[model samples]
Target chain A: MSFFSKIFHPSSYAPSAPSLPYSYDQQGQTYSTTSYPGNYSHQQQQQSYYGQGTSGGGGGYSYGHSGFPPGTSPDVIRSFEMVDRDRSGFIDENELQQALSSGYQRFHIKTVRLLMFLFKNPHDSRRLGPKEFAALWSCLGQWRGIYERYDRDRSGKIDLLELRDALYGIGLATPSSVLQVLISKYDDGSGRKIELNFDSFVECGVILKGLTEKFKEKDKGYTGTASFDYDEFMSMVIPFLVSYD
Target chain B: MSFFSKIFHPSSYAPSAPSLPYSYDQQGQTYSTTSYPGNYSHQQQQQSYYGQGTSGGGGGYSYGHSGFPPGTSPDVIRSFEMVDRDRSGFIDENELQQALSSGYQRFHIKTVRLLMFLFKNPHDSRRLGPKEFAALWSCLGQWRGIYERYDRDRSGKIDLLELRDALYGIGLATPSSVLQVLISKYDDGSGRKIELNFDSFVECGVILKGLTEKFKEKDKGYTGTASFDYDEFMSMVIPFLVSYD
Candidate 1:
């Protein structure tokens, strides 16, 4: 089975069974299973977490104990290095922007800034070195894990239905029509399939996660509910829509 | 003294003396001090923390003892209600986005996402009620505190020199040239003065904090030092430069 397919197989979803074995080299650019040291057991632990949603207390998903659950992959690290144009051991904002825009597709500058903010060290708020880059790489992996978990048919893509599940799984309550709008925005009108690949999956995740979190913030009192007028809703969702431009 | 001046006076930097008081209403649209209990004391605690960097172990700045340090403001709450477009007693994603973008200057979708993610409750990830919105508002207050603390002249603006201090205060080791480039980006080439206002200050803080944290992640050995190749350094610094566009 393909790596993505293998991870989504019904057998892998069994609460008791460990999921697939996945690991990356220190650079996080390459993937390997041999000589990976305790990764299988780690994957097992992670799979159990994913299978049961035991880490559901946070209202969002938690991939591993902390710090790069699947560990960093060589592919992720190499992506960062490619962006490090000057061969500096660190990745700064411009380099990061270039890397992200070119590699992951163009993200809003604010989104890129936020991602950098989210990924960078709290103490060293200037640049990202190898370890920091690894953390970022690992984050993508976590998102991948989320994507794979929801790609139940092992299709390596997420349809509208799967997208709904993915959002709900991560704690979003998007309306059907709103979701349709979102899907249509990304749909290239290629095939009848209204599905998202890994990149689109990540993008969708980013937008949904952001919107949901923002909504929850307003819903203080722990009531799980808040109100918004039309303008407020537009302000929140329009930026994420493709047509916002 | 002016609000900005009062907060940034050199004496305000004293470790023991409490700093000035600042608070936002529910919408965070208006700034007010009425009906805000204990916020002054809370500001005192927060200022002391900022002045001495007592919470310095993590290599990043820490705002409160827990979540919502200065607590929420009435204006922040009002802001949420204003955004409840449908009057359905709930502000959905679109409403939330509209409120945020129009109210807070157009933030990157990703940044908005991160804010939502950070502010939303763990258990209820769908909508944000008043309390959650308060938490989000308070976070902006915290960012404002950071901004005010660094606005040494109480100018309500962060000059390039002040920006340097802001970065350093947050535990970044920025080179002078890198700092210069960053200043030039926001200079506007008007007067010889190069500075950032509140919004820009907040943006700079987010980027700096993210990068610093990322750097610290790599300095795992805690030798208090990490190295970067030329390309790596470029990647790290270029993002903060003024002329990147």
Candidate 2:
């Protein structure tokens, strides 16, 4: 029989095909798909309320905002150029290195490692170009809490204070005593309250190695490649947080 | 004024603070906030006609029928030892490679690149264990199309006629005149049809450089480390496809 006929008429093809490709060798125990943490209902609710483009009457949903400019090849190139300000023909390791090192104090070793794992698989010599870089940036932008907190002065620099707010916003608490010590030690000493700049702020936070370690350990082995796979991440984190604290 | 007070009453803070961040680079680019792809009208029609989720109200629409089981632990390590009949502890790369090399014809290079891009990105690497692997397997089940075309008897094997039919499916016109030439060249003197089992069929497809190039070009260079930044990729591809085609 013809292929079209087989597809349309299952009887023509004989017994029903398997719904999914996976099968066990002999354990007879079906692989469980429901293992992610957090209530499925809650996760679905959160995604529906906040996910920017889950589904829509169109391929995209604007939610009553201005639509995306008609994307064109030139526009894509232009956007890439804006991100790769140096126009180095390719976004080499140096550029990514710079971005990573820019404010090292805020970055944990584990976080950086996690980021690297996504880049090129442990020094395979493939540096992320404009496309890979853009994807990561777009993901960071969608991290609502992080983005919201980082936009200090609503200007969005997240230079220092904003970063502080972000860490706290995500449930990482900084001890007040530690903050006091940092301010007093690093302040310009003009006898006025000190505004913590990047360096000083990172010092305060990074010094809490125990805290960083705890958070990192908590995030072990979650190397999913899709940002939208929040269910995966959230599931790991929530149960661990409840258990950890 | 206190920082909180200044924030609450923006007039109380230094006027320069709020304006400064926005104006640092460009003032008017107040984020697109909403943008997406494809024709809205078609999507709306599909939504109503097919009962497909198409709007902010439906969270699962982006994935179509590809839905993960509800309530999976993002960090839970569902032991695979029970699943692997040999107790390999892990499903090694060799298994995947062998599977591809054996039954499958040369996979589209673009599909490989896309898969690599998905697997390589760090943000998305959140422990792609068995369940996650199943999801990916389901999505790529489209490969069954190739198998179906070649396996003529529905007995999961291919004879000469089936192979020829498979080749012809790709627009490799097999004229009646060429059929005689091929039969004479390939068939046994006994008049039996020459057959290519899965392995030989795979080898033939892989050797086709033209098909490889087509797919590789299709799957290269996307940013979003966690997901294919459909928006960014489409922005460049759409314009090029429209103008060039």
Candidate 3:
């Protein structure tokens, strides 16, 4: 098979598949888990937010938002209200991150911003209102289903092959060159190969979704190609890259 | 802004932020585009396959499979036949790989196997029959919608941040460590920070999805954690790690 095909498919390629997961800390030493102190952390803040409600109990939180979309599920509406700690009927990236971390999964602020960007709330671009929150929540629900279905063996992490299949199942025939770059970005081990826990998988999907969506906008002709001036590209993408404290 | 947050969040970390994209080929030399020989490769075989069809006119393939699932799109069914090089009633990883490469984006063999595994064919596990092919095709359609939506900048690639957001939008709050490792895996640059072109993005998502699903099998409680005897873990993960010849 490799002969007939490999012989035929000569082309432009970048296949830098990482063999073992390389562990590197910023200071050039091994990253220690103890460095994260409990005194002050997004974790503590997130925990505090959850503590105010039924901590670890799937639902039943301090929700009072009556402005939710008419057909929004009580679970989703309450999820939004739970995150609106100030009772202001709005949730920013941090709040969204906290809420998800507590109720569903832990998300990075970067991911939350992408959510806000995609499920933009007409009420506020910086945050989500009841309507926008419901929309975003439902979207998450769909993805969750997809995630559950693909986790075939129930190992809590998908291996390299499974990941490839999942992408194809979704119509994105990802090239190997790109796959190497994509997985390498999420190195989480000292010397182990990278694998996707649910959280990591979600991150991977979101990144792809965002890139594909952004590309489609410019590639209006479905031409599989597009062009962007540098600054224009940065403004469009930077919001997803920076970590706002 | 970094004070209350950064102070409280002093902790364990692996912050090997690549200052620039370092381009390294497998041979410890720069991976040059010219290294790929055109005399024999999968590209030529794929080209020959396309030449047999209405090249670039999508949905025009030499399909003879009549066993497709009910309600299958004609486009998808036609696509299956296009890749069945020998006109067999089924397709395997290489065939799927070739079909996807020609019709949509080029996918790695590793990924095609994942699709077959996820959407296993009742007729054969090694290959996909009409039923499995149809199911896999439908899933791709759903992902296509998502990809277009997140490609916000209309640029061909998603910066690190966009990838982060897209994952969160889907309900997976990816951690920093994982994100870092993931992107580093796909380093396609000589000295450029990693970015997600559509193929790369899909590759990222597939890897994560596969990993997450595998992990879930052992994490029946949705515990976000799982344990495996060393041998079990290796068997489960090796398919993803190895590139089948």
Candidate 4:
């Protein structure tokens, strides 16, 4: 079966799909197919606002007022410039990927591409200038803050003990065995102490955060217990597996 | 077929499954069945640590040194007490659910149940004391901070415009139509201005975050595009659907 057909299979939608109340066109633009209850003045207002395009700033690229402008941290800006290897005052996909993976761990290529897509100016798709880079930098700053909070010993890197603490701090009740696997997987293999530098640390955090959210969704009863038949478990894990591959 | 059988069908494990390296017994406990490459001193250390139980904090509930104690925020503490309704100094499942669903909108029961499980002491699952409540509250605080940062008008709530920016800020390029559907779904119908209070705000954030992560996992080629067959789409959405139900 084709990918789209598999995703939009009739039976899967038959029992409970009405809850979505929206449909997608061939180009993947979503539209509301069902009439929402009530007068819904706000929705109308939004419709008109979106209709205005530039005035409403309603398109995919225009984030409207809530989108904070990028930060002005010198260290962060310097890092961005340094990564812009060509000195063209802009960082492209390759440069950004290199910055994230060099001297650390190799990031999944897709992750690098997504970051580039998100931070690149909507007007200029080829590269990221300082402002756009600053926004990306700020997001990293948030992750860095999380990393620092978990790095209790003030060490530049996170040891196995600290990693365990960091996972729990984020509210994931990760099994000891799973934690064991992660430490072994990310360790630099230097045989010093199983530790992760900032880049590796952030990657681990992202994966754990994503997986934990998915697990919570399945274990909705909050029983601290979840059972997944083999197929269900495979579905839950396929993304992680595919990414690693 | 039963859920477990569906998930664990032997055929599913025949080829690609070996890469997972972990297997579950009847109780759902995960153990590594494959020997990892290398001597893996760190894994040995962790095994010994976990083996010590009380000393190593290996049990499922122990959380070990990784579990940081709750913060001492007076305002946050007050909110927990307010939710405790019975003045018993503890929030039971019902009270906690009521608090989350009370003024703004009724959250999914499963979501509330999951929250309860995550915060409740593993040994005493019936209710949450101030410390446990505080931890949950602090996590909410992080979400609130993100909300406020995006809520430029300081209106104490998020409108459609703000919601779009918030999603983008978190790296999701949700189409405008999807944003419209979300706002309409959450608006209380009071009609002043379609907006979301703190509780509703946090709920929206959680759903968007989960979906975005899933989407990214699939769009690994970094083309900023993804296609899902019917089953794939259903898997992406089942969590949101089940929660609403």
Candidate 5:
């Protein structure tokens, strides 16, 4: 089975990684896992991460975990590396918030945390790594492009109608009820007609991606239908809902 | 409470969503939720979606869900919106795989599905909307940037040494032994040194993010340094590591 397939099959899953195997020997800064947990079957097969993100590289600097992520701009990567002043390869939620603020745009801490939560890497889910950071930048770039293109009136942000166009532009085509839900979520409670700023736009976009991605897995045959037992459903979702940062 | 915080504390969470409330009706094809689900307390304040992702405008502009994801692009959102074809304000795994592939690249179906298992939206958990899509994309973007930067040799991939550098470069400074486990998981068994392509990189990055994120929630201040009573740990992680997916 593919590594990912192994992830959802919880019967074979071991949430607790058998006590880390190795600990930092206070005397020697070195770590070792003398005995692996099922050789860390799923963890190794699917657990190691490379989160090390940059919610626009928010904080001073932090540490990094180990793992690989994929394709994005060198600048985004450079932004992450440069911020790794401690040479720790990772950026915390703050650092990530900082990174996005400096490198991309200033995103709210809530947004940044959500960003960290969604696009987190395999190894470092808490922080930002090069790979996930890069992906985030790219995704942002894509979202930005859409926003600009769809903000028909040049209002800087789009309205419910315009938002629909934008969503339709990229093919999302949400329903009016669903659209209202989206608009309300990013409404900002300003009580104005729902005009989405770039940040709001991104939040909307990633949530769509994250949730949709999760949904598709269960909707076998792409019939837009699937069923889950109670626990199964929770396992399918809890991650996005679960809070760490 | 922050929307994210509202997600994990399940008593407040209603997973089923009251049966979609409004259906296509098959007549005019218009959808309306006469009564929102608790005004979608968590869904709106927390529920509601905006998935519609790209997984790379997957499979013919499927449809769109609704919810506002933040910090991403409209395309990413559009990608998310487009993917939700169901307009249920969510995208199932099949849709997500399509979205990722359509919006980003052709992700291994398993990879996208597994990611859904790891990252979920409290609303549907089974699918995505704009809110979660942006979150996933944000993390995905970060992953991309890291992958590019860490693949220093321009070989389009990384070896154990490079992986370590990449992880360290970001902040996820994992132990060498642990890295070994990560490498072993993605190896192609070509009898050559272990190497990871972008897909493996994202997989590793996300897994790392998912596991760490989950562990962090339970571990609190320090990770790998916290102890859990068997039940608590299981309850905390069983949702993600369960066979439900």
Candidate 6:
């Protein structure tokens, strides 16, 4: 299974990484984990996040966690070193962007923008570092928050009843009319449950990715930069699509 | 009350709107009142989301789920009309640059490059518009979210306890230890909670205005056009700063 597959199927790969087996010394600074998050079975996701490129210094996301063995693998260490710029053991927006930008001449500038927005703080100048980066990737890699609403019963699939209740929990009670429309669109032949499998995931990703690319081009046009910037990348893109259909 | 203040106290002002009653149905779109959740007390908070500014023809976020009289002083609208060359209800980054250049000439080139990073998207050709501009403002205006981890109860205030929690939330538990080092040396004992009040709002607006100026300058620096081309903006600026603590 690729890492993308693993992220959506935590149950299938939970055994690969139990609790991220790393520890901290009072500070929130964490060490390296003994295992992978199983969901990241594929390496492309790492490439996307770390900013590594096959040819030279384009950029990509780093994969190494803090305090982990240095010789995990060239690809892994390369990922770590890129994000661990300044070797401070933390990968902030700066480091992450540096890591994620490798091997590509053009990226969706909006992605970088979103990243900068997510990590920015008016009161502090500190950027996200290694530990924070790791935690974020761990969460995103598995699409944890994207669930929107979850079926806690672990029934292996989420149905309308389960999804509706989850939305209600978040203070959003969809009118029955809207629900019917969504069901007719998403549900296939049978009306039992609506499961968002890999196809749906890929479809959603493609659509969002398209929107993201649009923002990147505009960002490039305004800034006059040929390459995509990490900070303003997504901020300029997400707003148009933040609403549900 | 100033525009920023009205966001917090909507009822204090008289409703003089003359257009169709305050329904979300403008521009052939049906918007839900629920979409404008929270009261005017929080509108100012939305304005500051992701560091929105008022330098050019960008959108402004107004709270209060009611109506504003028709001829209720087109000051805000003036800000938009100041640019919007075609008055098509949308202002691209280039239009924004033109609006700001007329005011602040020394906004510089690097600043525009940085600003572009803040708005780029990789998926589509869309740039910032009024509705998006308002939404972005709202998302970042709630300054509490920026520092809320430090303020536990969400009472919209930050105390010492809250500050300590913030330190812990970021992985540093020893508040006394780190605070003694960073804060004691740099704290200055101002007793300020870094509130997002009116004064700060103005300062933020000025900063965004500065961004507009910078964007115009960058465009001029490139082909002397009103807007910067994608390549010119990026190549001219190196190692752009994402944040300065």
- Per residue, candidate 5 scores C-alpha lDDT tens digits across B129-205 of 56555556545544555666677788866788887766555444445655664555443424688677665666655
Query: Taking the tens digit of each residue's C-alpha lDDT, what string does model 6 give over A1-245?
Result: 33223223344211111111122112223322111112211211211222212211322343354543322223334455555668875555445544444343222233433433333332332454433344334423333333432546665344556544533332223334333333333444353556543223222222233232332344423232233222232222222211110
TM-score of chain A considered alone, across all candidate predictions: 0.49, 0.33, 0.60, 0.49, 0.62, 0.29
Looking at model 6, residue A241 earns an lDDT score of 19
Question: Over 4 Å off in model 1, which ranges?
Answer: A1-196, A200-245, B1-73, B90-93, B102-105, B148-164, B167-245
lDDT of 3 by residue, B1-245 (tens): 21111111212111111010011111223111110112111121111111121112333444444775334445666566666778877777667666555343455554454455545643455677776665555444333334545667867567777777665554334455567645654544245767765445655554444444444455445444454432233333333331211
**Which candidate, 2 or 4, would have the higher DockQ against the true structure?**
2
Residue-wise lDDT of candidate 4 within A129-177, one digit each (tens)?
7666655554444455556667889886798788777655544444555
DockQ of each: 0.02, 0.04, 0.01, 0.01, 0.02, 0.04
How far off is residue B133 in model 5, in Å?
34
What's the true lDDT of residue A147 in model 2?
A: 40
Per-residue CA lDDT of model 4 for B150-195, tens digit only, reads 7889886788888777655544444565555455544332455678
Interface alpha-carbon RMSD, every candidate: 19.3, 27.2, 19.4, 17.8, 16.1, 19.5
Q: Residue A91 of candidate 4: its Cα lDDT?
A: 79
Q: Write the per-residue lDDT of candidate 1 for residues A1-245, one digit (tens) a residue.
A: 33222222333222222111122111222222111012111221213222232121222242342233343333444455576789876777667656544343453454444445445554455566665665554444456567777899988779999987776554444556556646654444345777776656666665555444444444434243444332233233323322110
Model 1 earns a TM-score of: 0.34
Worst 10 residues of 3 chain B by lDDT: B14-23
After TM-score superposition, what is the CA distance of residue A40 in candidate 1 from its true location, in Å?
Answer: 3.8
Docking class of 3: incorrect
- Give per-residue CA lDDT, model 2, range A1-245, as digits (tens): 22111112221211110110011111223222111112111111111111222111232322221212222123223444544548764444445434434342332332322232233322232344543443333322223224433566754233445544554543333444333333433334255545543323332333332222222332333221113221222222211110000
Candidate 2 regions off by >4 Å? A1-78, A85-89, A93-121, A124-126, A139-164, A177-193, A196-245, B1-245
Native contacts recovered by candidate 6, as a share? 0.06
